[model samples]
Target: MGSLLFLAFAYLAVGQAAVNRNGAQTAADAAALAAAQDKRDQLAGKWVEEVLDPTQWQDIFDGFAPGLTPSCWRADQLASQNDAHVDGCVPGPLEFEVSVEMDNPVGDSIIPGTEGRYSTESAIAVIEPRCTFELPEEDAGDDVLPQLTCKDRNWDLDPEDLGDLPAPEDLFDVHLAD
Candidate 1:
């Protein structure tokens, strides 16, 4: 009877540790995706601003110096929402890496060292752009004829038609990498 009781307690402790680890992993994934989405929003805003300026279109099309947005703020906010805190937040070109630790430890005291220890996990997320600008080589007496191509569809750069452009969310895709 004593041996059976000890075996059951061991199984319960292992199960509790697994649950705590899964919660930490979930928080890390959410934080990373939130950060990447923030970067996508920043890129879409810059694209719109540059599209309006005909002179800036060439630079953007050539993939010149692109603007960057700090996304660690959103990562922290998201981790907190998931009952965790981000231990580290790193921003890349269009991605973010976030590590989070659970607010509370695995409370089942069946395990010795794990009673006061919290679980931690990390994840990476990326944002991909879906549009590019193209210009025709035809010289037409200095008339501006900039073109915006997106997913094999070409759209005219009419100032009035700017309203017809895709929404910022549609302009970029954000997802967790791991």
Candidate 2:
């Protein structure tokens, strides 16, 4: 009976550790995705500002929008929401990498060292442009802008009337990196 009880407690401790590890991974994934989505929104907004200039569209699609702010704050916020804290957040051209640690360690585990140890995990998220456009031929009028096709949907942009613009999700896709 003593041996069986000890074994049960050991299994419980392992399960607790596994749960903490999974939670940490979830937090990291959320943080990375939030950071990438924020950057994607910024790029889409920049594109809307430079709607008439087809030359700048390519650069924006490639995640080269100038004067944009860092997106790490968004990652921190997301991590906090998941009961974790972001240890590191790195922003790439169109990707975000985030590492998160759980706020609480596995408590009172049978494993001696597990009681005070917290789980940490890292995740990466990528932003991919979903829209494509072809510049107008030479001698084309300045008022005529090229039509943008995004995810099989046609977006005919009129410089004079700028109301019906694509949302951030339509311009870029945010997903966890494989």
Model 2 over residues 71-103: C-alpha lDDT tens digits? 999999999999999999989989999999999
Candidate 1 lDDT: 0.77
Model 2 clashing residue pairs (backbone): none
Candidate 1 ranges beyond 4 A from true positions:
54-69, 138-146, 152-154
TM-score of each: 0.83, 0.96
Give per-residue CA lDDT, model 1, range 1-178, as digits (tens). Answer: 9999999999999899899999999999999999888777766677777766656654433333366647799989999998999999988776788999999998856668887899999999977666666555656433455666667566676765667765666567788885
Model 2 TM:
0.96
Candidate 2 weakest ten by summed lDDT: 106-115
**Candidate 2 RMSD to the correct structure:** 1.0
Give per-residue lDDT, candidate 1, residue 155.
66
Residue 99 error, candidate 2, Å: 0.6
